[model samples]
Target: MKISRLEAGFNYAVLSLFTISALLPLVGVVLSALTPRAEATGGLAIPSSLAWSNFKAAWAEGHFTVYMRSSVIVTVAVVALTVALASAAGYGFARLDFPGSTPLFFLLLIGLMLPAEAFIIPLYYNLRGMGLTNTYWGLIAPQVAQSLAFGTFWMRNNFKQFPTSIIEAARLDGASEWRLMWQVALPALRPAVLTMCLLLGMWTWNEFLIPLVMVTDESLRTAPLGMAFFQGRRSTDYALLAAGGMIVAAPVVIAYAFAQKHFVRGMLGGASR
Candidate 1:
């Protein structure tokens, strides 16, 4: 379908407006990061000096290395566990017929409906009892539980879309259940897996409330939690804050940039019907 010249122009204008609106803060934050402490953008004028040192200071002050390490630990653990458990759950739900399986699956879906805030009090008590609070396992356990709901839902849908014929053929060839899942089915679910990892990574990395509520030890804080602490220390230091914001954002942005194609495809592509 060929759009008219006027229509195309109007669409382009609308696109430009939306794009700018979305990115305006990002632009401001980047520019603000580069601006000097002495020169306030009182107006959005070109900065007389670029304070690239703000990035370095934010790093040292925020103890970014520690936070980054903690964040990576939590994110990697969460993604690995979620994919494994959810994949198993998805496959069972899709391919197996057991008593009350349907109802059990819906119980998992109920997780998607309830807000995380609703479970915080009870979850905290559980973690506290386990003596996991302020520890990596403490942070990881809650994330895994919260994630299982959506992860299982996503993988169930993904599994439902897979061809049953392949699974049957694998079984005919004497492939064990584990082998079939690991060697055959899992490979085909690459796009969905990638999408889930990217999504989960971003979510866990940016998570603030969970860390805030669970972690009291300064050393155990993730980047976002640490960023909040950094923000409080330098309340008037806008440039440093912006620089720190950019630091916290950079890794996830880079991950998405590399996975953009798979991410987009997985969002729209269903299992082959």
Candidate 2:
């Protein structure tokens, strides 16, 4: 059914207002980042000249190159591990009927409710005992575990919508379980997989708590954690801090821009079922 002209106009007006509200802060950040040190703190005024040096200063002072490298390694590893394990677990839960399946799935769902603050202390000590502290594994392992519950839930929802008849037909044709999952079902779950990857990458990229607690070595600090320390030292330097924030936020924004179509499709597909 078509909406009335009044409803359509009202919806557009509301959306436009929300869009402007969201964009104003970002525009302020851009302005602040480009403003000279003295003018940046003065609020959202156009600067006399673009302080292009703020980004360079932020990069150099923040040691963002090292932090970015660490972030990339951790984010890629977490997303890869999460997708691999979550897909298998999700497919199993969605398609199979083993003993204790429901109970186990519910147990896994408990992880979704648990907060990082609740487990970070014990997790830190546990990683230290395992000799993983201050290493990439220390950061990666917990994030993978943290991501798995939701990944499993997301993938399970995607897979559960597959037709049982098609699965049975593939099995009858001598397709092994692995073949069925990877070759048949997984291809159809591409949108969901991409969406999960995007979401997990964003979460891992922005994560500060896990890295802060588990990593004491300066070199292993991820972007967000590094930016936090950078801000602490340069708290008075608004231009530099804003520039640092932009640097940390840019990659995720670029990635989301590219994958937004698949992301939207995946979300709508899941919700429709």
CA lDDT of each prediction against the hidden true structure = 0.88, 0.93
Off by over 4 Å in 1: 41-43, 270-273
- Where does candidate 2 clash, by residue pair? none
Q: Which stretches of model 2 miss by more than 4 angstroms? A: 270-273
lDDT of 1 by residue, 87-163 (tens): 99988898888999999999889988988799898889988998999899989988998899999999888888889
When superposed on Cα atoms, how far off is each prediction in RMSD? 1.6, 1.7
Encode model 2's per-residue lDDT on 38-109: one tens digit a residue: 877837778889999999999999999999999999999999999999999999999988999999999999
TM-score of 1: 0.95
lDDT of 1 at 184: 86
- Give the worst 10-residue stretch by lDDT in candidate 1: 38-47
Q: Which prediction has the highest TM-score against the true structure?
A: 2
Best candidate, lDDT: 2
